[model samples]
Target: MNMKHVFNSNPLRYTAVLGLFAILLAISCTSEKEPLPDECEGSISLQTTIGSEANCGQSTGSFTVVATGGSAPYTYALNGGTAQSSASFDNLAAGSYTLTVTDNSGCTAEISVNIANQDGVNASISGTTASDCDTPNGSISVSATDGAGPYQYKLNDNAFQSGNTFDGLAPGNYTVTVRDANNCEVSLQATIKSDVVFAQVKNIIQTNCAVSGCHNGTTFPDLRVDNNIVAQASRIKARTGAKTMPPSSSGRSLSDDEIAEIACWVNDGASLN
Candidate 1:
């Protein structure tokens, strides 16, 4: 008998052969499904290092972030900002922030951080008062502590200077500002005083001009009163400089030294101090 005729004639044997072919096809299909990559299999992890605090009114704070255990080539973002390849961020003010890291396989990890503020610049100012009204011989010095060092000093809207001491300052109120290397600053009020010239001017007036007949309370420009002397400063400077005051013919003329003293007082802003 022929083999093909024998197989077709056996119905149970034909069904069994068909079932074997179906089992082999299912195994082949299952083998085609690929396994996940080893790199992208694990969970992502994050680590961070908190940075130094910022100074007053400055954005000098910074922090760093590192990621691992997910995939290679990660990106970092701060507070949901644009992603960057670098793990570090800088020039930040004191505040709270959220840092996020992402891997090549889109796996993400995050953490929260806080940047603090440093103590502001601390300073103490001291100075010498002017010796004479005609001279700007006063000086001021500042000693500062805290914050960054190598400090700069400024006096009353002037340019900043590296030196701690400022000379040739006039007698008056002054604003002293001190700034550190980090640009943290503090301000203080100072005063330079001159009692010598003010007293001399008063004495000269009282002994000569402010007497009975000259500039006493009855005179046209009463030099006896402090207010009147201030008001007539310009005239006093002019007349004394020209040697025309105390009237040479009156036999009570002022000496050259006295005239110069009055002129210096008048030129020095005619202040009572």
Candidate 2:
């Protein structure tokens, strides 16, 4: 039979063959479609607000990591350090740092951060000390040549105190720092002369406070005890200045000169005789 005549006679066969070819094509297309890879891609940036450096060699600061053009749910790391979800870091020293951000797709972006100290705080201090064998009284005053106006003061790494003048300090070497409103600081060392002896303080306490149950072992302050003399100097000075001690009804109040003497003693470090 001729090819054309055979094909025309079996139209059903041609239809079946065409249907089979269509099915095979569909299967091939389905098999070629593989799962796509997780594409991680993005960029990172750093923003910072400079933190004020504390007194001495220590410093403080903070920065933030900002990320964009990345997949959702990103993780952050600092200088290849621990991975943290937080984008911000605080209380950092003055120096350089790096931040890296990674997205869910394993794509990473990095940024650099540099920090420097602002010399806004330049402070100097001077003080007078009354150092004699009889009396050891001293005072210190601080001044700032730089930074903001209205500064505060601190002594020997203690908490920041208001005002630049410190009174009733003992005769010794002291470290004083001036901190301005901008939180910048400068430190200075001042030596207060100690001429006042512990013998005088002992005599004064025994003569006035030890009598009539005041500052004796029975009293709350108990000044007769030598161990806590230095510790109570400030409080003793405060009480004496306020005229709250030696109760008015006690019939034996301390004289102004006597109170001043106590201040001098405390300023001299309330030394042990």
Candidate 3:
């Protein structure tokens, strides 16, 4: 007579077991939901820094990119540059740039670069001038402002030579070029002049004056090309220009051109040919 009671007695128990199974299934599904971002891949971040310009003539600077929060073995690429294994890029000119870094997990990090080239190398001239008679062997000294030093010099398209100076240059027009370590270059014109030993005057002396008995030995100012020349160029011009030189026996009087040439020679810094 208790058959009905037996069936009804387990109804609540069966319902509770079914409810518990549903709760367990829900919890399992919630735990298995597509894993959080970090579980499979990490968020990517990039840090960058620029290196100062070191190589002079080079128009570019250097920069570095670092990546974090991704898989190992990263690859790097610049905006217009090729992909490289390392995060460092060299010889990049002064300007703004972007770097992209990719990790093994396909995650990407981007960074900005700001490099400075400062002013293109600036050069200054500070050496002595060259002239025809005096200081014929003069040299020029050059210096740089804003680039790697120990610069190189080029004269008239000649090969580059180390140092900031050009030496022993002859009197004339010159195109001087200065280059820095980075190969950056600047050009300028340089003129050399000398105030001594005018060839015309020398020829005049050797032809009309500088005679064996006149200015050879006992005479002052040695009016000859090879008559023991000295640093008396100004004195020679003073006397010659004044028409007090070349006594009667020394031949004809110097023409206006001849006198002007003497004055020019004395005023040109007296460089020797």
Candidate 4:
């Protein structure tokens, strides 16, 4: 069978053969297309730097993130919150958190971080009362624990010092603050009482100038008695102010502060009350 003689003999059959060939060619051209490879494969990565821990009972912690390997202009989201262009997050409390970074190509990476505290600075304060009238012999001491050291101490509005003991404080209410090396601080209150000036002066007189050979029964006015000391209050203030009391032979003399205290009592009317 010759194919050319057969087709020439049947024109309809030749037209049908051409139609089938055209259909087959059209089907081959319309087949499904193959998918292209992903543009961000194995290229999306994230790095982070943790910030300082939160202060005790405060939310001051933070962190920063840097993205690499993907496209530029990355955005960040913390704990699934709204995304932002800034790479840093702040005012966070002590706890665990998840951060996500997304690049311009829609590639994403995630990391976990934690914020913590350095422990609270704890403190206790103690004080001693002024032993004499209108004097500043009072003292305060502070004991600190926890947090970092060596610590610093201060009283009220005074400047900070390395020593925990504050001496020569006047009798009154006071505030003491203790601070650690990390700058964490705690405060407390203390008080010193005012001693009875009349009693204090009588004791000073009896112990120093009212001995058997001095202002006892043998001496005029006999200052061994409290009434006698009160009666001679003005003369006593004058002599003590001149630093001539108790006599150099008696091996005794009143301190400037003690003399001032006696003068203060006399100026205030020298009442036993």
> Whose lDDT is greatest here?
4
| Candidate 2 worst ten-residue window by lDDT | 28-37
- Across 87-160, the per-residue lDDT of candidate 2 in tens digits comes to 77777654445678887777777676644445556665544645542444568887666667777888887888
TM-score of candidate 1 relative to the true fold:
0.39
Q: What tens digits encode model 3's per-residue C-alpha lDDT throughout 1-273?
A: 354564488877667767886875553312222212223288788887766653434546787777878897899987636778897888765434567887887677777665544655556556666544423566667655666666778877789887677788755556667766776665554556654455666786556556555555434445554423325566667767777555443445777767766666656644455
Tens digits of per-residue lDDT, candidate 4, 1-273, equal 455875899978887887987875544312212223235644667777887776765678898988887888889998778999999999976545678888888777878765655575667765464544555687877777787889999888999999999988765567777778877766565655555568877877788778755677655657787777877787878888887776665678888778877876776556674
Q: Considering only N, C-alpha and C atoms within 3 Å, which residue pairs clash in candidate 4? A: none
Candidate lDDT values, in order: 0.70, 0.63, 0.62, 0.72
The TM-scores, one per candidate, come to 0.39, 0.33, 0.32, 0.32
Task: Give the range of the ten consecutive residues with the poorest summed lDDT in model 4.
Answer: 29-38
lDDT score for candidate 4 against the true structure: 0.72
Sorted by lDDT (best first), the order is 4, 1, 2, 3
Which residue runs of candidate 2 sit more than 4 Å off their true CA positions? 1-188
- Winner on TM-score between 1 and 4 is 1
> Which candidate number would show the highest TM-score if scored against the true structure?
1
Distance from true location, Cα of 33 in model 3, Å: 99
